[model samples]
Target chain A: MNKTLHIALSGLNAIDSPGPGVPVARGLREASGFDFKIIGLAYENLEPGIYMPGIADKVFIMPYPSEGIAALKERWEYILSVSKPDVVIPNYDAELLPYIRLNQWLKEKGVASFLPTEEQFEERQKYRLTEFGEKYNIPVPESHSVNNLSELAEKGKHLGYPLVVKGKFYEAGIARSPQEAEDWFLKISHKWGFPIIVQKYIKGEEFNVAGLGDGNGETIAAVAMRKQYITDKGKAWGGITVTDPRIMELTRHFVTKTQWRGPFELELMKDARGDFHVMEINPRMPAWIYLAVAAGQNIPLATTQLAHGEEVKPMPSYEPGIMFIRYSWDLITHVSSFQEFSMKGER
Target chain B: MKINPNLAINDTGFAFDPMTGHSYTLNSVALEIVQRLKQGQTEEEIATGLADEFDADPVIILKDLLDFIEILRNYELLEHE
Candidate 1:
């Protein structure tokens, strides 16, 4: 009989702004050489993944990271009491710090998580993107973190009008003038908080690579995609794999420099002159990760294996032209399930 | 307040409003309150019932119910009386 490994996953809220949990869980289910049960960690009862019957063998609502480590640890202890997971994969940015901090304790309990070193996680932060590029010798767009709204005018003039203004975490808007820059700054600040980024606008094609690193300065798998359809919020609604050796080389260099140990997405932009600049680095898998699995690489599964200290082979190559088009589906579920989960914190 | 006729909420806590074509998921407690409201339960009944049912503090239940009702209104699931 194949031994079943219990795996816990978070970021299951598949919605307009989706999370990476569902795709990661699907990849684990289809993963080669492993039989597993999935435990879903969710923040909201309404997160669609909780209701998706087969994906999660069981689901538990976790305390928000904002509730502080004590509450989070207590929740995890309760979850571990019910089921001992072999490994836990946290798929949200906000939840990452807690998981990373709890890594050693989780290992003491036999749960492993392949995550980046604290320095790696902190260096690649959106606010520190410039430092990342300079340190790694990767080409990155000139960007600065603005502390006050007044700085928008001075920075806009230097970077030229039409610079990109970005929130600390998510949302990026291009401002064509000083007025527009300040307006975007206020909008993004209001939603995502301060220290916004103003970047040299590279009016070019956007491409991304969803990759996994083995923590030994080698990329275990990498797949590049050029977004074909983008939503108003700047997410790829449809995207296709591309045959680009440049992105592969860039990814290798990045992995080698940082010795990054887990899944990551590199957002890049190609200028009119065909030069590519790293736009941002997402510390976790992108929501369109299933596309990489379809093309030829199973990144989420690979990361899971590496998490357990298993030796992994570098994926050979993937077919170009593989594509994914994301769409919304209405999940039909009963209120009782919601009540059971909410009242009991588990379902 | 009344539930929009075009809205359908299943036991799984999945809510759909055909008028807007936007679907939302609800927590278990929130789903129960919505169902209670649909059944024409008064705020007092809901507050008291939820507090008793969940073994929660009454003050917290009252606050939560009001917050959820406001959310329902925002989602267009609640019709203003």
Candidate 2:
């Protein structure tokens, strides 16, 4: 008999640089032996996922995490009383920490979530990546965190021309000269915050691996892909599954070492020397996670199962050469639907 | 000396490498050389055949064939040694 599970997830903004919420919901809906009632949690009224047909069975407006944990908890409490979700998946990086803080509360309320430990999450931060690499014996580009423009210029000069300047939370730009480095510093700092990261840049092809860990040093699922086409915003528009044993080994090594508890994506670069460098580690699934489902490993489904405390055997293999080309669709919806969600915070 | 057995060469002279998912378009001469290579023809045999078919010098055909094979190697379309 199939059991119906209520799964709540966030990150529904399906703009050019999409969020994983829609794809995650799609994967869950495709799972066998489980019927899912997807509840889309949105921070904004027009998240697109709210209006996308059949994507979310119910929609709820969530308070932004910056609004404080008390507000977030109050909102979720109301949601639990009404919807009674079996599991909640937070698909946005900015919201992960807040969700992690609420994991125990959710568990006590009979809602489960799979999230990394606080220590694990902090260890993988962008500024701490070099430290993370050294501790784990992984190869990463030499990086330094700078507080001000002078520090950035000095480190940028030391790292040589064409180095990478990165904001605290997001945004990275390649600065070919110290002048360019200062420009990026001002631009990114104005948007994000202080303490930018200056790192050695390795010119190479990028590869990504989406993986789920069992939280006990076991990799439940992993799929590697290379972007065949990239957008101006550095998002993958078209990608293909690849069979690179080295990348697979790296994924296993990362999972085994960290015992990562949930969905994670590893951004890697293969340099001219054929060596893989750890570029960044995103704490949640990538926007293109549906490709993992198409390639034979349903990562989102596995993650949901793990969160529900079900046993998930390791998915050790997947077919390569599977391609995914993204296309945009114009969804038509009436203004009243948006008004209902905006006015009442539920739809 | 060997091409990937899994490569799909279509009638439009387009080739796809199944291992890496990289695709390329082949010109007429390059397509002929790839087909001959797939048929287990050696460098000298492929050169001789191309020369007779196109009425070109065998020396020039062999030189161009070697260059094309080097490109195939760089693309990883050639099987590993």
Candidate 3:
């Protein structure tokens, strides 16, 4: 009989702009080496994965990272007392910092997690992309972070029109004119706070590579996919894996240079000259990560093993031309489950 | 011969590449070219047959055929030579 590993993970929204939790759970379920019992950590009760069948054996509501670390730790303490997890994987960007801070505490409590260091995480912030690009010798779009609309206009002149205005954490809009740029600046700043990132808009096809890097400067797995269809929210609705050696080489270079630990996704743009510009680097698994598992490299599975400090062989090859089309599914369940989770903070 | 072997085309000009799961809808002329390519017709042969059937300038037909082939190449419906 295989030993059961209780894996606790967050980001269970599974909405249009999905969290990576469901796909990660699905990937974990497919692991051949161990039996996995999933514990879902959610901030809201309405997260679809909470009630979705075959997703989680237990669901617990945790305080948001914005609520401060003390509240988060208290909630985790209660959770750990009840349903002990062998490993915890926090998938949301906003929550990653708190989890990283609590890594050693979790280790003391016998819960393992593999995550990027504080310096590694800080260096890849969206506002610091240009510096990151220069440090790593990667081609990145010229960008400037502005504190107010006046600074936006000042920098907009240098960068020219049709620039991409981005928030620190989420939301990005393409502004073709000064007025449009101000509109985006106002919208993103109001929601995500100051230091709006304005980037030079590169005209070309976008490709994304999801990879897992060993802490010692080696890529364990990398899967590249091009978005066939994009939604209004800028998430890939349909994507196909491609055989691009250049992109693969870049992925390795990124891992080697960063000595990046754990899972990351690189958003890249290939211009007409076939040169790739590093667009953004997400510090965790992407929502379309299941596509990687289907193509032959199981990143989530490898991440789980890494979290447990087990040796994982590099997965160097995956079948290209594999496609993944996202579709929505409606899960029907009683309101009682919602009530139970809301009242007791666990169900 | 350069067309992807995994491609499947139906009577109504619907093309699907099973390997990549990418589908394309071809026009009548484009469909004819794909079918001819599938049957091992060379570019010159396809151009000649298209010119005779349409009673048009051979040079124009060949140019248009080449453009369409470039589109196919961009979409990765053709195998790497």
Per-residue alpha-carbon lDDT of candidate 1 for residues B5-81, written as tens digits (9 for 90 to 100): 56678999998653333568988987898899889898888999988988989888898788888888766577646
Ranking by TM-score: 2, 3, 1
Report how closely model 3 matches the true complex, as a DockQ value: 0.22
Q: What's each prediction's clash count?
A: 10, 0, 0
Model 3: residues with Cα > 4 Å off, grouped in runs: B1-46, B49-63, B67-81
Q: In candidate 1 chain A, what residue range of length 10 has the lowest lDDT sum? A: A239-248
Residue pairs with colliding backbones in model 1 are A333-B12, A334-B10, A334-B11, A334-B12, A334-B13, A335-B10, A335-B11, A335-B12, A338-B28, A339-B28
Look at candidate 3 and give me any clashing residue pairs. Answer: none
Q: Report, for every candidate in turn, its global Cα lDDT versus the true structure.
A: 0.86, 0.90, 0.91
lDDT at residue A196 of model 2 (Cα atoms): 90
What stretches of model 1 exceed 4 Å from their correct place?
B1-81
Candidate 1 lDDT, A160-218, residue by residue in tens: 97789999878999898898999999999999888899999889889999999888898
**Candidate 3 per-residue lDDT over residues A99-144, each given as its tens digit:** 9999999899999998999889999999899999999998999988
Candidate that beats the other on DockQ, 1 or 2, i.e. the better one: 2
Please provide, for model 2 over A92-134, each residue's C-alpha lDDT reduced to its tens digit, 9 standing for 90 to 100.
Answer: 8878898898889989998999998888888998999999999
**Docking quality level of the chain pair in candidate 3:** incorrect
Best by the TM-score measure: 2
DockQ of 2: 0.52
Task: After the best TM-score superposition of candidate 1, give how far the Cα of residue A129 lies from its true spot, in angstroms.
Answer: 1.2
Q: Against the correct fold, how does model 3 do in TM-score?
A: 0.90
